[model samples]
Target: MNVLLFGASGMIGQGVLRECLLDDRVESVVAVVRKPLGFTHPKLREVVHEDFTDFSSLAGEFKAVDACFFCLGISSARKSEEEYRRITYDYTLAAARALPSNPSLTFTYVSGEGTDSTESGRSMWARVKGRTENDLLAMPFHAYMFRPGYIQPLHGATSRTRAYRLLYVGVSWLYPLLRRVIPKHVTTTENLGRAMLAVAGAGGAGEHILYSPEINRLAAEGR
Candidate 1:
């Protein structure tokens, strides 16, 4: 199977790319980026395109993809609601519209915990994410939203956001405890990646949304 990956330079995308490259079932991986990712592998290909809002120029490259891992996201830190929606909702929808739709084609979206599916929530970011997830689900292609909380990066996976990286460093020691005590609330990058691959390949465990425990379970099944 072949795959299209967005945000391969980000934390979650990095882990997914690593898993896809290592998996024998994946024949190729096309990573969409604004610039070269500097990583090299036989199965990995990078497509540098600056515009995420308009995929018209890149339509030719977005065809017949068996799976798409949409990990592109940005923190809502200081941005206005419009700015955040542009990145979180508009960019995701543009890519989804560009991708070819099929029953066998799976699209995995990496949302975070507390995402409000109702789209009428108090949290601005969650509402945007909820709307994004809701629209993706309405599409013809198979779609799954992964809502991971406290993701412990494994195998050199690091966040592109400096603040998140610093926070990860500060709380790195609590990963083991969280995994043991609150497995449903915590999952490592490795497990999340494997779980995505599993669902994309097998089309299960994605009735609607997936939390951390379900992700770990799917990963174990895939393994």
Candidate 2:
């Protein structure tokens, strides 16, 4: 399978890339990024473009892809709602618009928990994420949304926020404890990555929304 991947440099994206590379079924990977990903492989191709809004600039280059994993996301802290919306909502729609060429493409979105798209007057971040999720679901591609909470890393770290870094650090030591006490919403990066690839390869059961427990389950099954 050929995959069109975004946010290959980010944490979740890195895990996804690793899983894709390791999977023998994946024939080729086209990764889109703002800057060069600084890696090369026989099966991997990188496209450096700063603006997601103008994906059509490379529309002709958008070839047949079996799936698209949109892992690009930014923290809600230190940004206004409008700015957050542009990144979370606008950029997502931009990518979706370009994937119609890849008929029967499976789209996996990294959405957060507590997302509410009814234009509800609750948290701005959740509302934006919810709206983005809803909008992407409306697209033609077979879509799946992953709403994971407190994603712990598998190998390397790529969090831009210091607070997130700290949280990951704490999670490393407290994962066992948290697993015992935490609800099913929280999941680690390794599990999430494994689940995503499994779901993508097997095809989803309807428009699936995989919460943390489902992710962990799939990851376990994939292994």
Instruction: Give me the candidate number with maximum lDDT.
Output: 1
TM-score of each: 0.97, 0.93
lDDT of the candidates, in the order given: 0.90, 0.82
Deviation of model 1 at 145, angstroms: 0.6
Question: Candidate 1 regions off by >4 Å?
Answer: 204-206
The digit string of per-residue lDDT tens for model 1 on 1-223 reads 8999999999999999999999999999989999899879999989999899998887777775899999999999998999999999999999999986576789999999999999998999999999999999989878999999889999999999899999999999988888889878998889888988988977644555999888989899888
Native-vs-model 2 lDDT?
0.82
Candidate 2 C-alpha error for residue 219, in Å? 1.6
Report each candidate's C-alpha RMSD, comma-separated, in the order given: 1.1, 1.6
Model 2 TM-score, 2 decimals: 0.93
